[model samples]
Target: MNWPVFFTRLGSAIVFAIIMMFGLLYSHPMAIIGLALLIQFLCIREFMALVAKIFPEAYFPSWLTMLTQVAGVVVLLSVPLLAIIPGFFVVSFILPVLILLVTILQKKTALTAGFTALAALLYISIPMACLITLRGGAGSFHFAIPLALILMIWMNDTMAYIVGSFIGRTPFSPISPKKTWEGTAGGALLTIAGAAVWGYFSPLQQYHMSDWMVLAFCAAVAGTAGDLLESKLKRMAGIKDSGNIMPGHGGALDRFDSLLVTLPFAFCYAAFFMVHT
Candidate 1:
């Protein structure tokens, strides 16, 4: 292991963790929503860049990128404001309708812009909005759910790397060749175990050990899939990292890929749990 690279990654991760903690655990709901919006923009930017690289022949106008980002931000904000404000419901529909109209107006790059924006909306924007919804809105915001999700993903990733480095031999997938079956298994097991420990000791009495374990299972398995999905995109684009925003960690998308996919699955389960219980 290159010590310099490792230290760089560690340094960045510390900063990232601090930011995440502040964003998720902040007293106000807007903090996480703001952080989520920033993440949405960055992820969409990197994803669009990747798509551009993947399909060089396609014409990608800069305005569409801006529109997509704006749309995502508005949509995210609309979630918390929907109940509080009267017009927020209409605000959500306006942007999507505008997106369609804009795409229709572009005769040459219509499909390209439409689909790309659509994908970014679905891939980045919607997941983040789900995150906010999962966290609860302005009036009823609580951070534990999203915070635990992130912590479990971090734990799974860290343990997987350590375990894979020491004893991994079997390749986990072609998309991310560095990953190994041993590492993957170890990560999942440890994530579940860690969740169990948290559930056992956590003062948050709302959830039990089984709940934590299941959520951790979602994070580990879905996080792995998220990483591979990004890796596959990079491989197809013939690139190593998504962007250089975070030294040694690629980009925002690279960092939050797990959360994007994990949110939907975790949210579904959490929603079900809340409804059933």
Candidate 2:
């Protein structure tokens, strides 16, 4: 084990997490939306770049790519805005149509390009949008939800690696060679336990214990799947890291892969149990 590399990664993660938590919890609404938009832009950019490597000829024009990026940002911001102005929700549908129409006009890789655009919209944009929706809390801002979700993900990944490194023998999946069933199960248990402790003291306790437990389970399971999915994509793209944005952590996509899936799942779980109930 490279102690230097481990420390570098830990340091980078701590610094980055601080910035993110501050933005999510203390920043203005527009600032939070902007940060999410920035994340969406970067994730979509990384995803497209990776896909481009796999399909060389499926190249989109720079203008088209830029337009799609702008649309993706708009879609992310629109989710929360919709709560304030119901009409803003239309952008969600309009952006996809615009992407399809523009790509179809390209003539050469119309089908592939259009499909890729829509996939990015669904895969990257929507989840980011859902994140803002989670924070919005029916037009009011609540810092605890996103903060707790992120903490759980961090705890899950950290404990998974620790447990896996110490006693993991069975590989969890071929996609991510290092992951193990023992590690995964142990990590899930730790994440749930940590969340239980957090909920007991934090404002999250306002919700039922059962609700927090379900959220913990969703975050652990769906978050792990999301991590593996990104790993699969990286394997397909034949890359070690998505980008060099974070010193130790690969890229925005690499870091937030779990959150990408976890956010949407958590939102749905909360809606069904916490919000609706």
Clashes per model (N, Cα, C within 3 A)? 0, 0
Could you tell me which 10 consecutive residues in candidate 2 have the lowest summed lDDT?
135-144
lDDT of candidate 1 over 168-224, digit per residue (tens): 999999888899999999999999999999999988777778888988999999999
Cα lDDT of model 2 by residue, 168-208, tens digit: 99999999889999999999999898877766776654576
Q: What is the lDDT of residue 158 in candidate 1?
A: 94
Best candidate, lDDT: 1
What lDDT score goes with residue 198 in model 2?
68
Residue 275, model 2, lDDT: 62
* Predictions in order: lDDT: 0.84, 0.80
Q: How far is candidate 2 from the true structure (C-alpha RMSD, Å)?
A: 2.3
